[model samples]
Target: MSIGQSVSKHRFACVTAVCAIAAACGSFALGVGRSIWFDEGYTLIVESQPFARMMDLLKVDVHPPLYYLLLRMWISVFGSDVMALRAMS
Candidate 1:
């Protein structure tokens, strides 16, 4: 491409990368030290159960199962530490 177009493309990429980093840093900072509240505690409880049990609980509960399913997978990969769980969000 032309010089102007090339510069514009590079600038766009730089801006996008910077914004992504800023957002990630902000999210981690906000979430890292925070304690889990009642709803989050329920999520952790469900996540700790077996997959089938979690599914059963979801059936009676109003929330969807997909998040729990993904959280299960995340826990499998990352372990159930608070930091890991928070980072998954």
Candidate 2:
């Protein structure tokens, strides 16, 4: 790419990153005191399981397992706390 294009792409990436970070922080802050919704709780429980077990359980569920698997990675990195869980969205 040309230098101009490269600079534009870099700027776009930076702005996008900032916006994403701000949004996640805002959501986590707003949800700070509230209990996790039932669906969130269910998601957490599922994502917290061992991989094989998680796969087995997901076989019977309608939702895709990829979501839970990615969420499992997120939980492993950040945490399983209410705020951390909220930030995933």
- Candidate-wise lDDT, in order: 0.86, 0.86
| Per-model RMSD to reference | 1.4, 3.5
Error of 1 at 16 (Å): 0.8
Badly placed stretches (over 4 Å) of model 1 are none
Cα lDDT of model 2 by residue, 1-89, tens digit: 89999999999999999999998778767898898899898898877778888898899999988888788889889989988787776
Per-residue lDDT over 1-89 for candidate 1, one digit per residue giving the tens place of the 0 to 100 score = 89999999999999999999999899888877688767778889998897788788899988788888899899899988777787777
**Per-candidate TM vs. native?**
0.88, 0.68
Highest TM-score scorer: 1
Model 2, position 35, has a per-residue lDDT of 85
